[model samples]
Target chain A: MNPAVWLIGAGPGDPELLTMKAVKALGLADVVLVDDLVDPRILDYCPDARIVRVGKRGGCRSTPQDFIQRLMLRYARQGLRVARLKGGDPCIFGRGGEEAQWLSAHGVACEVVNGITAGLAAATAVGIPLTQRGLATGVTLVTAHTQDGGMPDWSALARGGTTLVVYMGVAKLQDMRGQLLAAGMDAATPVAMIENASLPGQRECASTVAAMADDADAFRLRSPAVLVIGQVAACRMYGAPDAPALAETRLRRSA
Target chain B: MNPAVWLIGAGPGDPELLTMKAVKALGLADVVLVDDLVDPRILDYCPDARIVRVGKRGGCRSTPQDFIQRLMLRYARQGLRVARLKGGDPCIFGRGGEEAQWLSAHGVACEVVNGITAGLAAATAVGIPLTQRGLATGVTLVTAHTQDGGMPDWSALARGGTTLVVYMGVAKLQDMRGQLLAAGMDAATPVAMIENASLPGQRECASTVAAMADDADAFRLRSPAVLVIGQVAACRMYGAPDAPALAETRLRRSA
Candidate 1:
């Protein structure tokens, strides 16, 4: 039997949102490779499968990309069904294509199952429309991490009439804000940061681009947070100005 | 029974991607107001329900926006369970908020069930990573439509190291290219346009942003096509030539 692999998207940390296809694959897996952002509850669906942790976290020891690929190949060569579980959708920043390409090149069959990305789920969960008529008609999903951990090109991002969503940006919130501001983005442009999105301990804070970094720190946000920056972030309608303002204050103090 | 409306996202034109929750809502809908882009196959899921075609198409005569809202209210007032089915996720340019707000103001309860957006699905189907390490750490979802049927603000969208996905953009492909070029975006930036993504007869063409509009017309693409622009668009190994040649073709043609 040829060893095969299934690449599954866990869907924004919500076990229930896992697609029927993903669930079926998990149940049939002999080995499961999961990322850090995937909810632990999903393991319950594959009680008989062997679980391996191959999650990557910034600024910490991580399983090398090449090593992970090798492990998948090795297991498949042994005729073991391997399931590579990724957070959110496998295609979005999950390096799924690379894995699939490698597997296909080595005569292994691979299938990609889609999942709900965190950016969309976070925007929906908070009642913030990523695109709205007469407000924002487009949205940009980005990350705060660069090779040097610096801000991305702000000159292009400050263009009006588009929403920007940033992933893994909590650590570089202040730098991102500074870049956007330097790029001529409005100081008052609305920004929202969601920590542990779709998880039970989820926390969402709304502020302006000028205040997001400092404010997120005060809220004590951790990694795996998603940042939504644009006019739509202001539409959360929490009914309290103090909530945003206080969160900013807390972030500034913590920083 | 108080009349309530549920707004459901149909997911990227594929009937199977519909969530179990969304399917349940459709099963319970007394009346379903579906958009033009929704696959007819989904209607099979609601054989017992009344299906209404209220979808607005670009360039074609569409039911007035206000009238659509009023129709929802009109149905709900008669104690009918209504499902407003939209192609792609409802909140991403689906005008779901306008409908939700209208319902809430009229004391009608509204529930929203999120669906997968086309951009992510398109990326997955074509093997492009929306966000990838050392390439793009971010992605932007944008539309090609504006209030006056012109291009949206392109200056802000030319930001480097980000992926841009445009929905309903086929008609305005040329305008979008010009605007992005004028806004300092590299002419060689990779772009992929997927027509009828994830469905039967799905067609995808890849070129640089400079060449996209011309080639798209050559392919005779239609509305409901998705445009993904950025470095990530170039990452897919779909047997296309590298970026420089594609950009040169676009430049020579436009010049």
Candidate 2:
């Protein structure tokens, strides 16, 4: 068997979301290095492979990325079909680029299997069309957390005509509100926060930017939520309008 | 048996890219309304269904979106499991939101199955990461063809730290190049155009903004191509450089 690495995106915890290529890759893997966000039940697809949870949970003692890279190389060198499974699309925010670059640098054959990122999944669950004609022509995907707490240029994103999806942004609503408001984005811009997207118990807190902080708290939205902001976010789902006046309601970010 | 309308994303022309959920939904459908971009071969999954092509191709007599919605309603009202298949993720650009909303307005049960959008598929096909740590903090998905040919605010996008993917952009690149250039983006910013992503005939043309007009003219890249711009566009896929000096070198949009 040709020993190469397969970087697979497990697709936001829904096993059925796995692509045919991902299932095939799992079947071929000799060992799988799974991140924390990956649904544990997904490992059953590769019953024959050894499973290693190399991911560090948020704010916990976690595996260093370099160590994970070294471990992948070690197994690949041993003629093993190594599969590194991340939570969503490997290209989105899971550090897949650095790992892919490392594997390429070492001359290991690699194939990246894309999956539905959490952002899209969250949008579907919340019933917002990410890019709508005449309403929003563009959608931007960014994370609330960045390397070393470096900030993203929120002002640029506040420009009209685009929707924004912020992954892992539950903790930054206050900061984002301040920055975006200062950047002149209307305080009434609709915001939809979807938690546990695609899962059975998923919840959504939809409101305008000015009230999202309080809405999130009142609704108890948690981590891993995908936050959508824009006119499209104000859109009512196909059949019924939930909180039809959400955009007009105002509340401060609850500390 | 439950009669419901399933809106499925057929993904970017690759039969194998269909998600497990999409396949399952296809199998349950009694009728399918397919868009032009979807590969016809994928219909085999639903052997028992009657397939209809309702897509309006560009520059040709096309099916009106309202007519398509009426057709979906007729089928669903008849208690048939109807599938509306569009190429790429339906939510990304396919007017899926409007369809789903229409169905809901009529009180018909509809479920949206997310599929990979063409932009992400193009990125994977081109071997460039859409979002890389530090290099690209965010990624934007937009379409060049908008209703009424109105313009998106190009000045804000010129703010660095984002990678842009423009769908149906071939016709608009020269215009975008001008707007973005005027908006203060670096003329040397990298751009990679991917045509027929995830298909056997897939090809790529990599160059810089300043050279792209000539490069696209020389290469003859056609519609359905995805344009990736920003620092990530300059990224060498996570391996040893395939063409180390691709940006400086000129390549026509290979047919």
Pairs that collide in candidate 1 are A139-B141, A140-B140, A141-B139, A142-B138, A159-B156, A218-A250, A218-A251
Which stretches in model 2 have alpha-carbon errors above 4 Å? Answer: A1-3, A240-255, B1-3, B240-255
Docking class of 2: medium
The positional error of residue A3 in candidate 1, measured at the CA in angstroms, is 9.7
Give DockQ per model, in order: 0.41, 0.69
Count of clashing pairs, candidate 1: 7
Encode model 1's per-residue lDDT on B151-171: one tens digit a residue: 777776675557788888887
Local error of candidate 1 at residue A24 (angstroms): 3.9
Residue B216 of candidate 1: its Cα lDDT?
82
Q: What lDDT tens digits, residue by residue, belong to model 2 across residues A53-168? A: 99776777999888998999999999899999998899998777778888888988777888999999878876788887777878999988677687688888888468999998
Error of 2 at A133 (Å): 1.9
Considering just the first chain, candidate 2 attains a TM-score of 0.90
Which lDDT value does model 1 have at B209? 80
Best by DockQ: 2
